[model samples]
Target: MNFFIKLQDKISEFKLQINYMKKFPKIVFIGSTNFSLFSLKELYMKQYNIVGVITSPDNPIHKNEKYFSPVKKYALENNIPFLQPGNLLDDTFLKNLKAWNADIQIVVSFKILPKKVWDLPKMGSFNLHASLLPQYRGAAPINWVIINGENKTGLTTFFIEEKIDSGKILFQKEIEIGKEETAGELEYKLKKMSGSMIIKTLEKIMKKQIKPIDQKNINSLKYAPKISTKNCRIQWDDPSIESIYNKIRGLSPHPAAWTLLFFHKKKFVRFKIFVVKKILKKHSIPIGLIFNISSSEMRISVKEGFISIIEGQIEGKKRMNIKNLINGIKIRKNLFVR
Candidate 1:
């Protein structure tokens, strides 16, 4: 009887080990930006079995300065395995990644993965895009949405495909855009939302409860190409004061909307505008004309109305509000923005 009892105990222990092994799937994370860092931290807190992280290599910040990607920094602090492959298709990198035996891969704010890499995982790879899929599908979704004066935006988790951001959707969560919100402010909110949404998505995927929807079925698609220097140049001649305000807010705090300022007819300078307030009353002033200059305020006329320049930075000068900006600079009554 003693021998028989020992034999049954050993069988029970083996079964327990197998069950514990099946409890969590091996997951690999790929990302480089702050958004990726937020999602990675959340997954780590949930005690997910994150096998590895893939991020961009550190870039030179300036003379003798270097900046590492957010994901890389987090992985080092936590002792997580990470790779910063310059070439994703390199054979050694592929072999090492394949050896990890990851069940699924998750990407956020990372470079586009090649087919060979994305297809390595058994359960497949998925990406967390900031905007609703099939819309704002490009490099700078957050900025584009606000630049276009969109009142609503959201996050989308979709399976990876050959085409960029053209994957089938798995989950999404929408949020309202505040009228006065800047791209930087909206980014903070979306980052938090993305972390929670990603966790829920992983759970559903583990339970096999999600149905991937094709992006083609979605209507009213709009593309959000990357923002360029030309795109950031403010066109004061544009007919709408509200639209100009939106543009300023959308690009504020980073790669800000810019315009030309002429102190004298021959002395022109570049100014980056960060914040502006719209004056709804109609103005007969010619477009691009500057007027109503006070010690602490400056107004510029647009096609249909005027805009108060609340905050800006003159070229080669520190950023300041209208009050401090005009403190030493002479303002001509007839001065107009070019």
Candidate 2:
């Protein structure tokens, strides 16, 4: 009786393995950043057939210091095949990619793919974009949405096309932006949600449950161009407290909203504001004036209000809260920000 029971258990385990192998299509994942790792992990944990991976080449952050992309590291640890092609249109890269014979490809947080690469898979390729279709369509959608004071944004999965982010949409899921959420915070939220969305998209595609739809009336859509140093500068003269608030948070913890500190026409230093709270009330002081510099608080006067610096970093110092930052700086009456 014991022998027969063990045999039955072995049979069940074999059947499970067989089902896992037969159900999922062959996949070749393409991604680079930590944002892309979430979806790849989900697919891996679900026992999907990952045939290959394509990611950006190792890039040097400092002289003679190069690091592997998140996707490449994962592929290496799992003993899965991978390629890091500098040019997507390279003939040798194309040959190796075609040899994988993937049933489908999934792109997440990766560079633009040429038509040849995107059209290679039998079931074609789909991309998991960070924003909903026909809106926030560009390189920095997550940052732009928050900077524009938008209360809602979401994710979209679409088929790859020649045009950037203009392909037929496969699925979309909307999320409400928090009242005081920073871009980094919102990105973290969306990153966690993206894993499940990628899985659902793949299942629906495998089951023939999705009907791709073309984007409509995109001529008037808002764009999310890459953030530049000029764009990150804090425009203190802007009348709206909300606009300045949004701009600061939208670029927080990365390409942060910055301002030049001045001590009576002498350039003092530059500071990057990360977290802030707006105080709205009637005020006669000139905008960009730094007042209330105390051991416990630091406030910058703005239009009809003051922007209380909750967290910030000096140009050459580490990030600190308002209290710590204030404690380190010398109290001066003539200090102001531009």
Candidate 3:
């Protein structure tokens, strides 16, 4: 009877292994940013079968230093398969990708995929976008959402399509934008939220419980194109203090909002503003005029209000608070920001 019991236990274990294999689908992940890193780690923790990762080619950290994308770094650390293809349409890359026999592909913060690549998976490919579908749909959704002073934004997982970000929505979770939240802060919050949402989406997809909705049916569609250098320049002449404040926060801490600081006639300095607050009390000072240069505070006047520069950096200097900046730099009498 002991021998029979041992044999039965072995057979039960074999059956359990078979069940697990059948339950988990072969998944391929495509991404390159911190957002992608979080999702990939979450999937691994949840025991998903991630067969391969496709990310952007390694770029130089400096003139000679090299750096791999966050997704590539994770894959290397975990010994998972990864590919960095310059062109997704390459026949050899396609063949190798097909060899994985992935049931589905999950894309996050990656470049736009070709149809041949996106359609390789037996089930279908999906993307995790950083904003609600049909609104803020483009490369710089996160920055634009905050720049536009949106009170509410969210993440959306959608079916891949030929057009950018205009895909069938699979799942969505709304996120609130704080009054003073910077784009960098919102990015962290969204990145953390994306992992669980993607897992939930996959579970529903596998269980045949999800129904993708067409984006065309959604209202209030707004496009968020890539941010340009010109776009990052703050227009102090604009009367809307609130809009200027939003622009400052939207681009804060990275590719920050900039303005011209005139120190001498026909010569000026470029100042990148990282943090500012709207002074509700109206001021009659001319727009873009700088005053009140103290150890801890500097104020620049706008149309109807003043923008207190809480944090900023000179073009060739390190970022610093107003106190440090004032202590180190001289305050010229004719200095003004435009």
Candidate 4:
């Protein structure tokens, strides 16, 4: 959710993509303002006439006293016209957007716009999605792709339509997802790719030569439902090694995947698993048992093998290597993680 995604194409190809946008006709960049900071800067470098920016209204921060505006910050820094209406469906928003007079709109991470808003631009209103639609379409496509163990995914620029993420694709470039890639990694990859793809799609439109590609039967579509605390909890009893391994890495580095454990005395506690390793199937041991412990290996019993917790953080403690926690905390033998 915090990172950006770029493509894995060659250096020459990247250059060409940037050039395509640099020579685009009038365009408007719309979407979640947080991820647009860097790309907005690049648009200015290319001297593209940014008719306006459409984003959600500013929100309050941690405390009620402080206010934060991610999109507004970027707009003010670059002196671009910005509209942050409270509701995208507001009549005022619709009326004002139409006044911008842009030939096309470049949507990145914004909410689903109404049909009227999507039709504002004369040429077309194009959106950049994190996944190669309609494979992964929903609120959290980047997270679900990595969670499902996808090898290759990329950004897609498509014409806006009434149905969500069901528009005709104008341009797409696939990027390889590493074996150990996390959701954070894929997000960054898609973010960067979308920026360049936006420019390329806009250039084709400038020349009035874009060809819409259908997405109805390209592949089976998967809905990427928003991840919550309930779905992120780790299940130690799972049999497959790959799924268990993914459970740890998919949520790694931010809002990390969690598991229930008992640390001190008989209290059940929650902890986040930061690192884990593969374990070959051996004779079954009691579930959640601390089967083996050594200066070298901190192994715990599972259905088929030992799931050794290499690194983690207790409910409120800072994350540290398991070796350090083992040395510092007094882990009782009868304690268990269920």
> Evaluated with lDDT, which candidate comes out highest?
2
Per-residue error for 281 in candidate 3, Å, reads 2.7
How high is the CA lDDT of each candidate model? Answer: 0.89, 0.91, 0.89, 0.75
Superpose all Cα atoms of candidate 1 onto the true structure and report the RMSD in Å to 1 decimal: 4.8
lDDT of 2 by residue, 1-338 (tens): 99999999999999997687645588999999999999999888878899999999999999989999999999999888999999999999999999988999999999889899999988999999999888988888999999999999999999999999999999999999998999999999999999999999998998899999998875779988889999999999998999999999999989899999874346678889999999998889889998888877778999979999999998889999988888777656777899
lDDT of 2: 0.91
lDDT of 4 by residue, 121-228 (tens): 778888877888888888777777777778888888888898889989998899898887777776776666656676677777777788898887755668877779
Error of 2 at 312 (Å): 0.6
Pick out the ten consecutive residues of candidate 2 with the lowest summed lDDT: 261-270
Winner of 1 and 2 under TM-score: 2
Ranking by TM-score: 2, 3, 1, 4
Clashes of each: 0, 0, 0, 14
* Candidate 1 vs. true structure, TM-score: 0.90
Which residue pairs of candidate 3 clash?
none
**What is the Cα-based lDDT of residue 109 in candidate 3?**
93
Query: lDDT score, residue 148, model 1?
Result: 92
Measured with C-alpha atoms, the lDDT of residue 302 in candidate 2 is 93
User: All candidates' TM-scores?
Assistant: 0.90, 0.93, 0.92, 0.83
After superposition, the stretches of candidate 2 with alpha carbons farther than 4 Å from their true spots are 1-24, 263-265
Off by over 4 Å in 1: 1-23
